[model samples]
Target: MAVLSFDNVSILQEDVPTLQQVNLEMNEGDFAYLIGKTGSGKSTLFRSIYAELPINSGVARVAGYSLNDIKRSDIPFLRRKLGFVFQDFQLLTDRNVEKNLSFVLEATGHSNPDEIRFRIEQVLAQVGMSNAIQKRVHRLSGGEQQRVCIARAILNKPLLLLADEPTGHLDPEVSLEIMQLFKQLNQQGTAILMASHDYNTMRQVPGKLLKIEAGRIFPVNSLD
Candidate 1:
């Protein structure tokens, strides 16, 4: 089943054109890397999937919600079916790992404390961050924080994960580790569409490669 589809879609940033006539699709459990230079509209495309930016024309669907026709009140629910990870590790700095994961679970309608706790433990262990459940976000190392971010993103078992430069801030060694983690998640049945410029690491953890260039997205056989 297709979790994300964009057909001849046009996207704008600040009233300026970004991606135009873009068509793309990803099925359940698939992985694809979105590669582009800085300011090539990779993040803009990601935003459109989550309705953070509007699709100016054509059809766009994510996690079964139509971006063009989705209602304002439905946005939050739509997001519940999708996950987002960022380079900057968007965890709440004031909270410990458990609280951060709990916040997502509670906000998403999980009320049973025991179930929530179990789910938290499962995701944290999946990302190899179970031991840091009580550590403050700022106290963890860069890689540890990113692991927590991944943990938080998967709390609700999203159908698709939109990761924008998830390893952009980490060093090569740490970035490779995160890529391996992503591979494990993909193998376990979560579809992932990650925007990255880390060509070496991406090649090591191979997936379908798509490039955004000249206001469009298409497949590329090689990162070069």
Candidate 2:
């Protein structure tokens, strides 16, 4: 099954067309890289996928939710099946790591205390942050914070992960480490569509290539 699909979709930003007649698809467990210049439609496309932006035209579906026809009340449920990671860690800085993660569990309808604790432990261990569960979010280094963000993203066991410049802020070494972590996640069966501006770094990793230019998106064999 396709984790995400867009057929003849057009996306607009403030009445301006950004992506037009876009056709894309990603099957379960697929890994793809979305690359484009700074004013390209990458962000718009991501927003549309998560139902933040309205589909101007055409059929769109993500994780089994129809985008063009998805109701407002169902958006939250649609989001529950998908995870988002941004370049800037979007955690609650005042909260400790455990609090931040547990908040997500509760919000997503996990009520059992034991179940929540087990899920948190499982994700933290998967991201190599099991030891920092009680640490405050503000105290973690950039890499550690990003790891925490990844762990939080996966806490719900999403069918797909949307990452926007996840390594844009880290140093080269740390960025590589994060990329490896993403690779690990992909290998374990979660589909990933990552948007990145750093072509050199992104090209170093192996995945299907996609580029947005001239107000549209299409597959690419290489960055060159």
Candidate 3:
């Protein structure tokens, strides 16, 4: 089954339709790039996939759950099947790296201390942040913090990852590093749909391009 499928769907934010008659899909192990100008509806499309923005019409299914019929209580369940990485590196400022990750594991119902610790270690290692496990969020560089965010996102072994300009705040070198990390994850069978404005990064890490323009999405061979 498709990890994400949208068929003739319309997405709305604050009662305003941002994307109309959209049709898209991502299968297991698919890697797709979402690119668009500012306010061109890239984020809106992402929000709709995760149910943060409501679907106004047509069919939308993600990780086996139908967005059109998702209940409030079911939202969390659906989210658990996906990972989200934000550009701001939204780590808990007051917590250390391990604790920040532990908080998510606990919230997601991981109760055994050993298992939680093990999972935390595993994901941190995946993002090459295992050594920074005890570092305070405030002390880490932007790249390290973003690595932590990526580690946190994969803690639950999500089927799909949704990244919103995850390398936006990093330097060129760091951005390349992050893109490599994402590629590694995709190679390991995790489907990824990332929204990025960096056309150079897209060239470096090629994938199916989904471009949003004037609130519509269509495939393109290249940003050029």
Clash number for every model? Answer: 0, 0, 0
lDDT of 1 by residue, 109-180 (tens): 999999999999999999999899999999999999999999989888899999999998999999999999
TM for every model, in the order presented, reads: 0.97, 0.97, 0.97
Model 2 reaches what TM-score against the true structure?
Answer: 0.97
State each model's CA lDDT, in order: 0.93, 0.93, 0.92
Higher-TM-score candidate among 1 and 2?
A: 2
Stretches off by above 4 angstroms in model 2 are: none
Q: What is the TM-score (0 to 1) of candidate 1?
A: 0.97
* Model 3, position 37: C-alpha lDDT score: 90
Which residue pairs collide, candidate 2?
none
* Per-residue lDDT over 56-87 for candidate 3, one digit per residue giving the tens place of the 0 to 100 score: 99999999999998999999999999999999
Worst 10 residues of 1 by lDDT: 41-50
Q: Output the lDDT of residue 86, model 3.
A: 98
